[model samples]
Target: MTDTSPASALDQDPPRRGWPKVDKVWLALLAALLALAVLDRAQLGPSLLFTAQALWDILPFLVASVLIAAWTKATGLDRHVSRVTAGNPARAIGLAALFGALSPFCSCGVVPIIAALLAAGVPLAPVMAFWLASPLMDPQMFLLMLSTFGWPLTLAKTGAAIGLGLLGGAVTQGLVRRDLLGEVLRPGVAPTCCAAKRSLKPEPVAWRFWQAPQRRATFRASGLETGHFLLKWLALAFLVESLMLAWLPAESIGAWLGADAWWAVPLAALAGIPAYLNGYAAVPTVAGLIELGMTPAAGLAFMLAGGVTSIPAAMAVFALVRRRVFALYVGLGLGGALLASLGYLLWAGGGSAG
Candidate 1:
């Protein structure tokens, strides 16, 4: 029997044409360049030069980070995330928070693993810990931040990431123990894809990945894919940063985000929720703001708040969970950013209160 029905055929091989899509980051990059060319022709040349020089300066750190990420994926160490984070509830939450900060999973890559963890009956608290932390700080982000702001701020951000994760996990766990969190998953929801389901059962780690041909291929593929992703986002980020440096005045930035503004830390956190640039693009953006008189505290707050609530990370959480859970996620991100910023401001002694 030949089953040649139109619907069946379409299901087997979905139509690829007529789907309008564009990478937002690349689009922004192109639009920024176009705007510069049309509005300020003289500045265009200087901006391009600035972006190029900035990219060149960060190239070594970028390559090192990308290689490390690829190597982790190739060696299968990422699979141990579940194993290592398992055990006593408190212990699991702590381990999960630490892993989330250190792991190299990107916004999308982390989604499947998170979905799997929840589906496998892992408590929502620890998963929330990992979810909140994963996007905020990773090896790649650490290297980039170190290159831009030096070790002190970079380390501070890393600590904030872990602290935020722990806070979310603890609060969520308390809510759950009281049965206040209600359902963890959306009703009738299931894994969106096979990969999401498959992540529940990860393969064993192969420490000596080079001994296997498949692992070598994995290394090459992951490296190339990661390299392309990092390059494009970093390029776009530096371009926008160059424009910010050229156009946005230091006084305007300082007025809102400077040390003298007592409310600057909270304002930065709230501002970050709406203006969240995805994690990689944010490094240079915050650096530019810092250079333009934004206080270190405000910059850190913005980064933490933005990283957690960035569109991709928020969307991933939204798709898997109910409305209240999503709200909690946002609240935690905002609150954690505020606390971290206030503490840093007091400790750093950047400026006098207004």
Candidate 2:
């Protein structure tokens, strides 16, 4: 008989070599751009200072994410949330929207959780709702806005987020096909080995000397993970802030999205599609627009559309779900943004009339 042992397979040559013949020229291009960015500015001292300041500003959000993740893991909250989501689609959407409204997560930061939820058989509607709601509706952002922009803008933004989230959920449920969901429509099974290992592990003895070291080690590991996850985003936020501060022609942008135009809201929403800034970074930009005579309604619309709708998020959903369903999801976000913008305009107008 022919030998087909695992050892024989290990000894065989790989099918392809030299980085699998894939092109990584884009990586080189990015490296070149980074080199230019560093060299373009002579004040390395100031650059380092700015980077530190940016990191300090973002630290609270990063800390909050770590704490939330740890809490969820420790209290088995993730499991409970999974169970709720798996129980019923309608209830799942409500829970997800509420959770999204309350959680302190950026749109991009929430992607992994959303992916896990979808993988765990959470309905597409609720998953979509969470994705739309988490960035703008979170308590931190809401509270920050309340202080910075006052109660009116804060209330308007929060209402828009919740309304749009619910609308998006309904639209997604109405449009998506059951069969296209395939295996993703069912609840995920926990790994048997993980539970078994946890059961088998012995409880540690209470020793102060060892406890301090262990705690320190745990914190250090957590800090490293949080830094790794957030550093790039923090840098990107700084770059956007810098661009808005220095190069963007505010007068031109304002003229294009002027208050008198009927197309202003939709135009602003469409213009925001290419923008990658999250709510924290976007708040300052929107404030700048308001300073430039952009109406509060238009600014709110821009923030909503820009914060929730992103090319990357759309691409991730497309990769995971059916093409038709992906299209529906995109439509929900874009359409919901437009509808919310219109709703804001009508509500504001009605208030003025009254």
Candidate 3:
């Protein structure tokens, strides 16, 4: 017979701490905004339309993201990336740019991940590239562009993102010294597979899939980890979407960025840098601008430039890397956006006249 007293239970196992407390104030604020969104029927139609458009626009980005994520997991590319970044600065930048183009996280969502990667001894250049590219190159943003702006503009944005990433990485590799990383930089860890050199470890393929009893545990673990990582960031992104949907005026933007206005593209690129808005928020704004008379090219420039050149992003990179590296990242993004815009104008002109 077992004793059922509380003291007996306490003696059997120590109490465990609960999960971290949610920010109730933030939750309340989100709830209030959501209520307002539901109540404001006048704005509902347009908001839904914009969101639908955004959903369509982001499809390509989504497809690309799926492919990239699968590739990373299958190839053990994260481990390889960690090794390359640790060993050579140039390779680090290239890999970072490549990874950034493929990663699903937006700018704000990526902050903690970037910090973790840096802490884990990834090279500064690639880390910076990841910061720049994550917002610009994600799958949802690509789908949003495809639906709202069309393919030409989507391609241009993609090109600019890749170009800026490469240029930024190269500049960072050349300019930022490893010593500046200080305590953040550490010796690289070998791949988990490599680290476990003994035959005692299970094969990689078998380990990826588990026995029925273990499979359930593995799925639960993965779900918990992913949910913890994405939930807060997703909430923030949704809030940004709500704000943009409520405020940005379509007519004013169309009038401001009309195709005949050659200066509009560069102006848009410059204006975008300080906004700190991600592609998720900016897409609706661009759609509004399109309705306002902004050309596809000009809108694309705003989207790409806005996502990559935000003050928060710049400052983040500057804090982690050197001033020269930061400057180069900014310059490349600004320059690439401008070039893409110009090319669009020329192409559109030929198409219209032809």
Candidate 4:
């Protein structure tokens, strides 16, 4: 016979007692700073400044995007995702690809928005399309690329962004159709903030969420949780990015990618997996590489590859999905980048040679 009393249950499952622990992300940030101080004291100040500046620059987008996700959850706007998912699959995928390419959200900033969508039962295909493209190109990036490179390269990158989104969406759709993509979200990840407590059926929208006490509470809790989650990861990501910039010179990237051999294009894409700084920072680097004899096609490959798989972007994706889904995300990014590069090469009439 089992002892089923409350006392027995309490004894069996004791509550933990201690001060709240710091998350690994915060510890990682601290560790990076300490290592910089010990090894290269001169870079310590610069690195700190760089992380601070980058965080500051992104804070507005972070706040706005987080609030949007929270609002959607609190007011039941997520029902609209069901409507979208119910539409024609091909049309939804195409629209999502185009919209993601034009959306202002950065790679990391779009995480919370997509989390809400997925948790609310949005189909994986269109979400994957947006996930692939949102990090690659935006209006600001397009203009910046135009100024740094010529119009041809800028247009090529924009095209790559949309094309990659389409390819990723189509692949994800096939996998989902075959019932291969099981349980995309990692267990217990963003359960509260992203509204992972999903309903079995769509709920009606309550546009004025503030009118109800429960809805107001949900809004506050969701926003706070999402904000905290984003801050820690982005802080660590920016710190790592700062370290990468300080250690890896643009000239080395140029040298590795400057070769005229056919292999250099794919090599550039692979190198970009780790070597990329960010879209804004990459423009001048690629331009310098071109001046240093890197072909236009290779530069395009490097930028397209890095745009999707940068450390910050990849980190965001890893935090949201299970390992298998994350693997797919990376594979799509690398493969799509290569294909886009080849297409641009063919269309540009031998690219640099022409």
Which predicted model would earn the best TM-score? 4
Model 4 clashing residue pairs (backbone): none
Weakest ten-residue segment in model 4 by summed lDDT: 1-10
Which residue pairs does candidate 2 place in steric collision?
none
Error of 3 at 92 (Å): 3.7
Every model's TM-score = 0.58, 0.62, 0.53, 0.87
Please write out the lDDT profile of model 1 over residues 160-198, one tens digit for every residue: 989999999999988988988776666424322332344
User: For all candidates, what are the clash counts?
Assistant: 0, 0, 11, 0
Go through the candidates in order and give each one's C-alpha lDDT.
Answer: 0.70, 0.57, 0.55, 0.77
Query: What global local distance difference test value does model 4 have?
Result: 0.77
Best by lDDT: 4
Model 2 segments more than 4 A misplaced: 1-84, 177-255, 311-326, 350-354
Best-to-worst lDDT order: 4, 1, 2, 3
lDDT of 3 at 242: 45
Cα-based RMSD of the predictions, in order?
9.0, 8.8, 10.1, 5.4
| Candidate 4 residue lDDT tens string, 53-112 | 977988887787678767876777764666658679888889889999998776666776
**Off by more than 4 A, model 1:** 1-87, 107-109, 190-259, 351-354
lDDT of 2 by residue, 223-334 (tens): 3443443444445444433343344533455456757467888877775555545687777777777766676667777777767766534433443455565666667667
True-structure lDDT of candidate 2: 0.57
Model 1 residue 102 lDDT score: 91
lDDT of 1 at 216: 77
